[model samples]
Target: MTKESPLKTLIGLAQDDVDTAAQRLGRLQRERGEAEAQLQALITYRDEYHARFTESARAGMAAGSVRNFQAFIDTLDAAIGQQQRMLEQADARLEAAKPEWRRQKQKLGSYEVLQARSEATEARKSARREQRDADEHAARVLRMRASNP
Candidate 1:
């Protein structure tokens, strides 16, 4: 079996790291989006509960069924409180993830930049070596012509 070149191995490792980081970043973004959606849904539920409680109170005054209506309203209020707490927790998680996501993205960018610079440096070095060889060939040709003439 042919062994892989060290440079190729290093490049492969770097590429793997980049791919892993990208996947992790994508997952974090998806999680954040899901968290936001859940929070929005909870807020909607909370609003619906509040509206129902208000209507129930108005109906209770007209129908003289205050006790049962108040109990229902209290239950809805408790549900709304629970949902609000959940929404706040989701928001907090999203906030905590933001900085970590940014840092990972920055790390990926820096790795790409370093790879590009290394490629450019290698190209420049190769070009310089080729130029030096061409110059030596020209000098040898000049010496041959001078010696023969």
Candidate 2:
């Protein structure tokens, strides 16, 4: 059975935490992107509706028609209302996700720091062990030579 050093184990745990945090961050980013796209689409739809409404009104005025202009105005208002609601929802979602994303980023930073510390500790331990072994071997060689002389 192979035993793992405590520092190595800690480093592994930290890395796993970092990976998880990164995944969460990525998910949040994707969500934000989707929300932004949806918001932009809604804005585009609103603009198109506005343009149609204006054109309809102008045509109705030229033809002395009332019903078409009224209908276009109603449609434009409804579309604008829907777009406003969607924009509000998107903004809320984005605001809510921002804090969570920030927290995940902070957690990733902490994990990285922990991993770095663990690695440094492990490296120091390895160097110390190597130095101790070398010192022991030199001491043994000196004893053997003195005994032989």
Candidate 3:
């Protein structure tokens, strides 16, 4: 069995880094999407609740009921604001992950380029060796025929 070269080991390590970085970026994107979805849901619920509250106030509502409705709406506003902040934070994290992923991908690409060049050079050397062997065999055959004749 042939021993692995340092370049092969480096390529493996680079590939692992790229995979890990991509996973991290993907996870951050998922978290951002979930945060945005939750924010949208909260906004939709708040809008529907406010519409109902408006209709109830126009028809009739006791003082206590009005106060409770207003307070609940205020609470919903605060929660919506908090969710917006969370979504912003998730966006920031996702943005941060992108650079690392790009860096890892570039490193892997560099290693792959080196590997390709090395393989190409080795193939040329092998072809040269094969040509030399064939030439030597032909020369030996010619020498043997001359001696026999």
Candidate 4:
């Protein structure tokens, strides 16, 4: 059984960490996008509702109806405020995830660089060994031919 190099093992683990971090970052981004979209929808709905309320008031609503419209608008405004807060929280979470993702990727890159250097060192050693063997073989052949002559 061949033993795996420690650097290779570290590289594998780093790759897994990087993948996990990337997935987490993607999830955070998706959540933030969904929150932002929901907030936008809420704002658009509130604006449309306010416009309708204004049109109705101009068309001569009763005092009770005017109060009801104002109350409902206030409720919509409160909901919009809550949605804005939710979106802000989502944005914060997404921002927090980014650094972790970058760190994991950097670790993986460092491992890869180490592995490349190790391979290059091995190749140089192999080349030197091959040259030494060739030189010894040529010297042995020359000595044998001179002895026979």
Where model 2 places Cα greater than 4 Å from the true spot, the runs are: 1-64
Q: Model 3: which residue pairs collide?
A: none
lDDT per residue, candidate 4, 29-135, as tens digits?
99999999988998899899889888888989899998898899899899989989998999999999999999999999999999999999999999999999999
Instruction: Estimate the TM-score for candidate 1.
Output: 0.64
True-structure RMSD for candidate 1? 4.1
Which portions of model 3 miss their true places by more than 4 Å? none
Worst 10 residues of 3 by lDDT: 52-61
Q: Once model 2 is optimally superposed onto the true structure by TM-score, how far is the C-alpha of residue 28 displaced, in angstroms?
A: 7.0
Weakest ten-residue segment in model 1 by summed lDDT: 59-68
Taking the tens digit of each residue's C-alpha lDDT, what string does model 2 give over 57-141?
7755554456665676677667667766765676676567667656766765666677688788989999999999999999999
Error of 4 at 3 (Å): 2.7
Best by lDDT: 3
Model 3 C-alpha lDDT per residue in residues 1-149, reported as the tens digit of each score:
99998889999999999999999999999999999999999999999999999998899889999999989999999999999999999999999999999999999999989999999999999999999999999999999999999
Best by TM-score: 3
Clashing pairs in 4: none
Between candidates 2 and 4, the one scoring higher on lDDT is: 4
Q: lDDT per residue, candidate 1, 70-97, as tens digits?
A: 6766776776677667657766766666
**lDDT-superior candidate, 3 or 4:** 3
- What's model 2's overall lDDT? 0.71
